[model samples]
Each structure stands twice: as C-alpha cells, then as structure tokens.
Target chain A: MSYKAKFRVWRGEGGEGKLEDFTVEVNEGEVVLDIIHRLQATQAPDLAVRWNCKAGKCGSCSMEINGKPKLGCMTRMSTFSEDETITVTPMRTFPVIKDLVTDVSFNYQKAREIPSFTPPANVQPGEYRMQQIDVERSQEFRKCIECFMCNNVCHVIRDHEENKPEFAGPRFLMRIAELDMHPYDVADRKDAAQEEHGLGYCNITKCCTEVCPEHIKITDNALIPMKERVVDRKYDPLVWLGNKIFKRSSSKS
Target chain B: MTQTTADSPARRQRAQIKERTLRTDQWWRYPLVTFIIFTAFLVYSTWAIFDTSYFASPYIAPYASPCLATSCPEGARLFGLAPFGDWYTLPPGLLILALPAGFRFTCYYYRKAYYRGFWLSPPACAVNEPHGKYTGESRFPLILQNIHRYFFYAAIVIGLILAWDAVLALVEKPVGLGTLILVVNAVFINLYTLSCHSCRHITAGRLNHFSKHPVRYRAWGFVSKLNAKHQQLALISMFTVVGADLYVRLVAKGIVNFPFA
Candidate 1:
C-alpha cells in the first residue's frame, strides 16, 4: 500500500542551510534514498542529494538519519511508522560542500599520512606467502567502504574541530591496524600508529564500532589489539632489555 | 539547486553560518588546572634531580633510588656499579630518573593530561585548539610514547627499589615522621603503577573467551577497577614522588630534622 511519508532534510551550502520538510509518497519495499529520489522527481526537482549504488555498497549516501549516522540507501521505509518524521542531515565532521555532500579532505589527509604497505625484501609480489589466519585478520579490516560514518560519529573530531589535526579518527586508524596485523607487510607501524596516527586520542568509546555498517569490531579487534602490541614493545622490561642488547626498534613487520 | 515548491519549506531555516561551537561554560578551567599542575611537577623534578646532597643517612631521596654509582653515600648504595665509572659524573638521581619519567610521559592517563594541558590539543572539548595541523604520534619522537608498557616493567622495578628505600628510610631508626612519609610515598607509587593502562591491558586484553581463562579474567577485573582511578592516582602519585624528594632535600639542607633520632 502506498503512504505519505514526512521527511525533514537539511538544504543549502557554504555552511548555511536549513531543514526543509517534504511530504512524499512512500512505495512498498522502498528505502529512504528512494523516497528522497521521489521528492526530487515529483516535487522539488532541484533538490540536491548525493547517492550511488542504492544497495548501500558505494557508501555515497551517508547522512544523519534522525540524528544517527546511517546510509540512506540501506535504511528501509519499513523501519519507520507511516506517521514518522525522519530528519536527515549532512555528515557533520567535514565541511559541507553542498546539500548532503561534505568535503572529506580530512580523511584523505589521514590516509596520506599512513605509510603504504612495505613488503619484505626476501619475496617478490607473487612469491609472497602467508598463512590463512593472517589473511583473515587483515580481511576483517578490509570491510570499510569509505563511508566516513565512523569518522563523522567519532567524538574526537565530530565535536572538537581542534582534535581533527591530531586524531586520524577510527576509519584510518583501522587501516593502520590492518597493515600492522598483516604478516606479509614488513613495517614497524606500532610507533607510527600511536605517534603519527593519533591512536592515543582514542579513549575506546566504541562509537565508531557502533556506527560501522560492516559490523567491524573496530575497537576490540583492531584498536585494542594494536594497543596491546604497543604495550608489548614499549613497556615490557624484557623487550627493553632485549632491545638494548639486540638494537631492534618496535617496528614489527 | 532544488526548486522550492513554495517560497520556504515547513522546517527550520539556518540563516547563520554554522561553524564549530565554542563551549559557553568555563571549559578552560579543567585544562588550565592540568597545565599548571604538570608544569609544577616538571619544574620540581628538574631541580630535584640536580640537587644530589638531599640524602641524610639512611633516608635516600626517591629520585636517587638504586644509587649504583661511586659518588653515592655508603648507606645510599643499592648496588655498586656505575658502568662508566668517573665518566658517569652526574648525580645518581638523574641516572634512574629517565625510567619513571618515560613511564609517566607515555602513560595513557598522563597522555590525556599533557595533551590537554601542555599541548592544548583542543584543550577541552567544544573549544578550538591553537595548532592548524595535527600529525598525532605518527612522527619522530612522539612515536616513542608507544614504549609506555616497557616503562611499566621499568616502573615495577623502580617501585620495588623505592619500596626498599622507604624501608631503608627507617634503617637508621624506625620511629620518625620521615619514615612514615616514605612509607606513604611507596604505597602511592605502587597504586599508580598497578593502575596503569598497560597493566590493565596485560591483565585482561586479547582474551575472547573470559570463561576459559577465569584466572586472567579475575585479574583483569581487579586491574579494571584500578584503571578507573588511574587519573586520580596519577595526580596523587606525582605529588607523592615530588613530596618525598622535597622532604629528603629539606633534611639534607638542614631545614627539616626529625626528633626520632
């Protein structure tokens, strides 16, 4: 059965905008993005919204749904009652370039800071061998679709613009953790993760983990385990004595 | 641009430029206090490290524990090896000071304190920081902060040495106010060290099934409790370490003398 759905979407640009209300037709088995499209086609054709891959794969439709970070493409209309008013806003962590489209240059800068995968000199690209367990460990972190929801939800930069400089946020830190966990990749990322990537800023709030569409155990598997590795290399006395004698840095390949 | 079906939609219009919020409350108070306190400690420790004459028989200064050099007093010697001999010309206090210093510098709680206090990295939530760019701990010297856990092991050994010194504070005679203060100092150091983030992680982290490792789980619970009071312990511990040094310094300088003798 077709029903009228109420949506409050924020519109405008240059850091100036407002939540404009619209009463749109909601079709059966349709998502929030579909309703947004309907509003664009039927009512306000000039309404600006960013989306691709309506299946939620592209992560381009990321926005705040009812104050919660969510993909418009994944949120089904069935989740809400017919009388509900869904409020959608642009991602808050970055500068809004237009309605629903934010300039995610902060994420790009963090990505650039992370040193690329440094392979072992002993093996060529195809000759590299790794255990299945090692691959699985890194594979879990690979689920990130660059949605930036985790980044937007993170309090480090979400509320505090000043912390944006130091904190690499959850998304990129997970990337560093992934590479650090990769057995075939030879680089000492432990120090870099804390010193460069702002791993220390993370208070283990797990907000990023909660907002992750991929259900990645970002806090438990990646961040916490990385913290453990740092402890092993930095604070353990045996490691200190060994390093003093062996002259090895904390770079675990 | 989307066509407005009517002049304006039925929602709230944002007429003003939306920038980051500036917290209304005196949010600077927290970080300001933190800044003053940490700076005071740093200055005190620097002075305490240089003044090696702070030892009055049997009461070794907390900073100068395990005085393993030739310049040490007969009673101050914890072990007899100043590897470089005469080349190790500095006071014994400076020798072992780096361990505890490193431990505190990389400490998770202290990191927050200093990040907010010293660097003004946001200073507090909802307030803008001074720096335009943040490279985090990924770069050169800041990356060394990752070695905090290693410092924890060092702290354990240092704590043990301090405990021995506290016991030794009364070696000349047990019934003194000086001995009492030393005992209290030792307790504070132990609490702070045990409550460390690394200690908490070592106690319980990386365990998927807590039911199987019941003993580890139990240890983790205890550490977690301590971890909760880490910030408070960190402050108190800093005070006690400096206070212990101050007491010994005053005694050595002929200002503080107990009647226990």
Candidate 2:
C-alpha cells in the first residue's frame, strides 16, 4: 500500500550541512533509493546523491540508512514502518563532496598502492594449469562489487582519518589476499601485506563481512588466512628452523 | 547561492562533522552482552577449578578432565594413569586447564570477542574506540596470537581425552543424566575444536595445487564448511563445557541428584 513516508536526509556541500526533513509519497516494492529519487523529483531538485545502478551490483548507491552503512538500492523501504522517520547520510569513512556523495578517492588511492597479480616469466599465456579446488579458494573473494561498504564500515579508517594513509582497508587487503592465493601469481604478497599494505591493522572484526552486498566473507576467507600466512614467514619458530636448515630460495630478489 | 572557489577550506579537506558515529541503532548492546557472558564464564570457571570436588561416580567436570595430578582420586584419574605422579600436588584443574584455555585465548573468534567486548577496540562497527593508539596484533603480546595453531594441536588432544571420558561414562552401568550431559558436551567440544580457523588453514592453506593432493583437498573442503560455523560452535561449546562441568560438580557435592547414577 502507498503511504506518506517521512525522510530526514542530510543536505549540504563544502562541509556545511543539516538534515532536511521531507514527507514524500511511497509505493509498495520500492527501495530507499526510490524514495530518494521521489524526493529529488518532487520536492528537492537540488539534492545531491550518487547512484548509478538501481540494482545492487554496481555498488554506487551506498549510504547510511538510520546509521547503518548499506546499499541504498538493496535496502527495501518495506523494512521500515511508514510512521518511522528514515534518516539518510553519506558513508562516514570518506570525505563528503555534497549530500550523500562522499569523495571516495581514498579507496582509489589505496587500490593503486597494491601490486597487481604477477606470474613467473617462463609460464606463458594459455599454459596455466590450476585445480578447480585451488581456483575456488580465491573465487569467493572475486565476488566483491567494489562497494567500499567494507572500507567505509571498517573502524580502522571509519573514525581514524590518520589511519587512511597506512591501512589499505578491507577491500584492497582482500585484493592482496586474492592475488597472494592465486595459483599462477608468484609475487611475495605476505611480506608486502604485513609491512606496506597495513595488513596488521585489520583485527578481523568481521564488520566488512557483515556489510558486504555480495556476501563475500572478507574477514574469514581472505583477511584471516593472509594473517596466518604472514605468521608462517614472520613468526613460526619451526618454519624459521626449516628455512635455516634447508635454505629455501627467496621469491623476491 | 554560495559558490565554492578553489581555495575554499571545505574544498581542501574532509567535512569536519564531529560525532562518534551517526548510528542510531543499539550498537552498544552486543559488546555489553559479550562482556557480561565472558566475565561470568571467567568467574564460574575459576570457582569450578579451585573447588576440587569435580567428581561423581560416572562423571567428571570438564575443567578438571584428564586429571593429571598425583593427588587425583582413583575414579577421576583419566585412563587410571597419573602422568604427573606425586611431583604435582595441586588441583587437577590447574594442570589440565592450560591447553584448552590457551586454545580459546588465542582463538581468532575469541580475539574479536574480547577485543571488542573487553578492550573496547572500536567497541562496534563505525564507532570510535577509546584507545589513542591501536597496534592491533602487530606487536609483542597481541602478536603472540599467531601461536593459535600450536593450541589447536593441544585442543585436539584435549578433545580426544574428553571423548574418552564420554566413552567411559557410556560403558559404565545405566546411562545417567550426567552421562548424557558429558557425552553431549564432549561432542560439542570436538565440533568446536574441529571448526577452528587454524584447522581449516592446516587442511588447505599454503598448498599451491589442490589437484595433486586429492585427500588434503577433500579434507580442506570439509574443514572450510565447518569454519563457516566456527563462531556459533565456539559459543555453544563454551556454554556446553561450562554447563557440563557445573552438572558434574553439583552431582559431586550431592546438591543435585539425577536418575540412574
């Protein structure tokens, strides 16, 4: 059934803003994004919001609905009662450019810092052989939609802006993990992950896993395994003894 | 309309909105509940450990299981073997508690629990933590969490011992309510132990090609499935272990009696 829904949307630009309340008409089977669109079309044409795909896949319509970081398109309007005043705000981790449109360049910057997949020189294209089981390990991480919800919700950068420089956040760390687990890639990601990419900053709160639109187990499947791998190289005494006795060849020059 | 120039302060940096988080939800409830449960477990476990009355006819307290002390009563001693002999005179709980305790302390799931629940390390998602600095698991004491795999081995041995206790209870006379409790607790403990993240890693981790190792691949597949339910198993097993121990202790004290024992 259609009803009048109350919305308290944050509207501002250049760091100055306030929550503007609007009573808008809503229909059945509509999402929060649909309501925002209605408000923009009817009440506030100047309202600035970032959205690309109305579907959940593109990860463009990410915002905080009632203080939880969620995809605007994925969150159903039916979840909230008609009398409830729904509040919409931008992702807290990144800087805001306008209402609900934050400068997400921090994620882009972190993405650039990670080393892409690198294979051995001798292994030519189309010659790669991998087990389906081995392929499946990294395959779960491949489902990431670059939603940055994981990054935005992660408290390491969400509250601490200073951490933005050192920590790569969950998204790129998962990327590093995916490449490290790749059967073909030979780059030594374990050391780089710990030392450079700030893998140690991640405490595996599983918040990233919680907020993921694709339902990827970011903390469990990717981040935790990578932590354990780093432990093998950096901490394990038995591994240290084995390396000392056998003198294993270093992957990096 | 205010036009923003290139030199504007807002253009230069992030919006200076000052609040811990905009989250209107009851985010504090989770950590608070976690804190209460963990603290209660700690207090209960300490009482159960030091009381030294953890034995009835067919049942033994979980915290005091595999009783290794020379002073352990004949019936409570595991496999009728006193490995420590008279050299160790303390309560059986003191000797046997280390392995399982260490395992849980170093557990990945428990780390998240205590860190958020006790340490308030960003108490909940998107909320500000009280600590000025966060070294995480990068440094000395916290870095020691890497040794969780070692504890996993200890936990396996403990699990086996607990299973043996359950078997002993089963074979003895009529199956009492205590026997059933011990068996269920043992099963839950084994499930929790098997579902460890370290177990998953040891099963499949570091292997570049799973095609070559079919057996390990199958084992990894089983473990990966179990690992998904690790957190739930951790909680259930925690409760079961304590409940099992408490039941046995009550029976020993003659405070509560069940049928068939």
**Cα lDDT of model 2 by residue, A1-253, tens digit:** 8999999998887667878899999999999999999988999998888899889989899998887899999999999988999989888777777888887888899899987889888999989887787778899988888889999998887767777788998999999988888888888888988988888888888889989999998999899988878877887887667667888643321
Per DockQ, the best of the predicted structures is 2
Give the Cα-based TM-score of candidate 2 against the true structure. Answer: 0.95
Off by over 4 Å in 2: A243-253, B1-9, B12-15, B85-87
What is candidate 1's lDDT per residue for B92-141, written digit by digit as tens?
88778889999998887787677777776646643445766654555456
- DockQ comparisons of all candidates to the true complex: 0.08, 0.53
lDDT of 1 by residue, A144-204 (tens): 8999898887767766577777788889989988887676677888777766777866755
Worst 10 residues of 1 chain A by lDDT: A129-138
Error of 1 at B93 (Å): 1.0
In candidate 2 chain B, where is summed lDDT lowest over 10 consecutive residues?
Answer: B8-17
